[model samples]
Target: MADSQWVDWTKTTQSKNYRGSGSFATFMIVGPVCFFLGILFASFPYDFPLLWTSDPVAPSYYDQLETHLRFVHQSPPLIARLLNIIMTVGFLGFFIKLFRPSEANVLFDGASLVLYVIGAGVYIANIVKGMRAVSAGVWHTEDFKGIAHDGPLTGEIVLGREDSLRVLSASNTILALVLVGVLVLQAGQWYAERREAEDNKKADQADKEAAERKASASAGSGGSGKKRQ
Candidate 1:
């Protein structure tokens, strides 16, 4: 009976989508975003003072700022490239799954992809632009103009430095929040899939028990007839 039940369960599971593999693919897509989130969080201490404080930029701050800027310049581009590669792979997998004749939850994958694209868009549109501005040291010439500048210091526009830093910090904050949203969406997908698997398992068990009871009743009826004869 146990063996029969196991065989029935295996067949039932095989008839459905390969959800475990799908979930693994989804994680691969999300993994880099999570890493980016960690980077953003870890930089808060280095970023907050430069962004929020009204105190004059001390000469000593330049060293720390340079270190932070160097990291900002180097890390994100690599991370973004990695993210793009992973997203491409994920999309390929999604298409393959969609074409399969199984009951795959394509909707979840579609929604996740949409959210991830939005997050990527946000990063590219805002964060990447900010990074470029910082790298070129040309923030004052772009964007807002109505705000009065603090005038030049050390033969360069001090306000531009502040503005670029602000842009970088603000963009990072927005990207971090967007990544959080992506994480939440993935979490919900995982939970829904888990619940679905449990439900399927229960249904399979119920069907197996019903089949066993029906067989037992038929056997009993046949024996009773033989005894009467």
Candidate 2:
């Protein structure tokens, strides 16, 4: 069944309206990549500490000279921002692929891509804001106040704390959800096509079998009549 289904799929793909293999492969691959990137972007802020602090037991964190000097402290925001840039480009790629001619649900794809752009835009803004705030020697604490910390804090700040980073995290989640919907809609279209091809093949086989059986029965009847004469 799988092999026959593959044959049917190959035939459908060979149609003039079907795009080339490159677009087809990208259509399948890029969506999930965007989704994973969304998850990474959403989770990264929580994993990194915003407060700059050296002392583990310190109650109040300050923006110490070492925080600026230490590359390790700055790496998290830098890395996150870089990844955000990559994912932003990924969203563009997804958008382009979504708009390409295909048999999938175009309306759903277009809507999903629009939501993706909006969500990614919000996320990018949040990350840029964080990077800018860190570079300026100020950290937006979980309570929403900007604090000047001496070193990076180990405690995790949950997103949505009335801060711009909250917007970033929320947008990432929204984008992920939208991408998932796009996947579902595309899958639905593919499944429908596959079922249709299989049904057509079945109908053709049934017709051929009926014709062959009628011919065989007629041949048997003619032979009996000759023998009886």
User: What tens digits encode model 1's per-residue C-alpha lDDT throughout 51-119?
Assistant: 667777775665566556756667756876775786566555445444432333344555656666776
Which one is best on lDDT? Answer: 1
* Model 1, runs deviating above 4 Å: 1-24, 47-67, 74-104, 139-164
Candidate 2 residue pairs that clash: 51-153, 52-151, 52-152, 53-151, 62-149, 62-150, 63-148, 63-149, 63-150, 64-150
Query: Alpha-carbon error at 54 in model 2, in Å?
Result: 29
The per-prediction CA RMSD against the true structure, in angstroms, equals 9.3, 10.7
Model 2 Cα lDDT, one tens digit per residue, 1-229: 6554312233244355443223564454354555566655655544234322333522232233224323333576676666666666655655554443443424434555665566556545654454454554334344345433333775444333224334544544565565566566556555666776689889999999999999999999999999999
Give the worst 10-residue stretch by lDDT in candidate 1: 4-13
Residue 28, model 2: lDDT of 47
Over the full model, what C-alpha lDDT does candidate 1 score relative to the true structure?
0.62
Per-residue lDDT value at 124 in model 2: 55
